[model samples]
Target: MNVAQVRRTSGESIHFDVVENFSPFELGTESFSFSAPVHVQLQVINTNKAVLVSGTIETELKVICGRCLEPFDYPLNLPYQDEWAFPAQATEELLESALLLEKDEVDISQRIFEQLVLALPMKFVCSEECQGLCLTCGANLNQTKCSCKEEVIDPRFAALAKWQAND
Candidate 1:
């Protein structure tokens, strides 16, 4: 993005509408792919000391269910807000969280990538009632019930169970 215009005067602002495609990306151990093009609508404002960029990123993602391990579509509408401080006004706190605008042009690709990563959830479930998989036969319980008999007690606790029953 070209910040030359907005940086020329305080209170000056610009609006941007961007539509682009991104390849599959990984967040920790999970991987995600975009099912649709990413759409971004943003406004950039010059506040003399800093430039404020706020926007929304919309997309549909193909994700795997953490429980059932099935593929599903997850829609994302993420809000993004960040600041770029002028060299003279840059403070320690701002410098740690934001980037310095030393030049007329700024590349926001890194910011966008960070936003996507931060928006990811720790776990993904297809539904609340998902039965997950059978431990003995490794079968999807949601689809079918396995013939293996379930033992509710841990093998290590079997001796304790008998002692408690006697008491």
Candidate 2:
């Protein structure tokens, strides 16, 4: 079951269980994992050509931290709601497919996955106070301190330091 089927609620008020093992994003990515599963319950309403999709997906996601470039795991509770149009003239077979957009077939799961992928913070700091890697030695500050002096200021500004002493 995909997002489109899940979003399709009958006239009498329908509910669907949405499921997808892999969202197609992990196919060629180096840092993302395909082992995690995605599942959700969608409640939808279709009025004319308009379809409303609302659901919550709770699953485990594996991604490499943008900061340390190390893979990490996170539990996701992704709430999704979107309105789309699959024309009344559209083939019934196509309308039932997941992520079906307007005149053409567009999978909602793909876009939703894109949203989930893009929504992730570009920089994932291990903690709020993460000191990050040492600029000079490329040492992970969270694990160890670098022997290189941090106060090695540029020589061009050396004269500025002595001005404070004279004042």
Candidate 3:
């Protein structure tokens, strides 16, 4: 959504309610996708040379579990606040962090998408105690166990196993 800087007069605020459906935005890896429509309610307050933008974004994300590699739905309700400075009043350093008002308007869709990306969890898991698949037999450990005996031993740790046997 685009917000016109000129429309927000001094001491006046404008509110917007936007519903946007993205065509499966990629999240992190190609295996995960977010195909939900986002609902945003934004408020822009003009303080003469600067604008304060605050809003809330709500959506359901379809993400792959990093642990079990399962697909699941994750709900998101993110709140964001940002400042926009008019080009004439902004410094070079401030422009890096704050959005710059160019041609009397600012597009906020990109900013919203960026916020959503930042808000995503560092690790995606189906559950806290989820048992991931077995590395040897490729069996879902959460559902069933395999008869494969995993006897992996590092070359450096081979001597340690002999010491334990003597005890």
Q: Write the per-residue lDDT of candidate 1 for residues 1-167, one digit (tens) a residue.
A: 78899988899999989888888987776678989888888899999889999999888889988888998888889998988999999999889987898988888867787788788788878899999987777789899988774664687699888999999
Ranking 1 against 2 by lDDT, winner: 1
- Candidate 2 lDDT over 1-167, as tens digits, reads 23344335434234668678874344334445544687767776665455666787766677655555456676677787766555553566645653345432336566567657766665555566766767777777777888885676777667777776688
Q: Give me the runs in candidate 3 sitting further than 4 Å from their true place.
A: 5-8, 27-31, 147-167
lDDT of 3: 0.78
lDDT of each: 0.86, 0.61, 0.78
Give all candidate RMSDs, comma-separated: 3.2, 6.1, 3.4
lDDT of 2 at 118: 61
Model 3 Cα lDDT, one tens digit per residue, 1-167 = 45564345688788889898855666545544555788999898888777878989998888777777888888889998998887777988878878777655567778888898899888878888888888777778877877774565666788988888899
Clashing residue pairs, backbone N/CA/C < 3 A, model 3: none
Best by TM-score: 1
User: Which 10 residues in a row give candidate 1 its minimum summed lDDT?
Assistant: 147-156
Ranking by TM-score: 1, 3, 2
C-alpha TM-scores of all predictions = 0.79, 0.61, 0.76
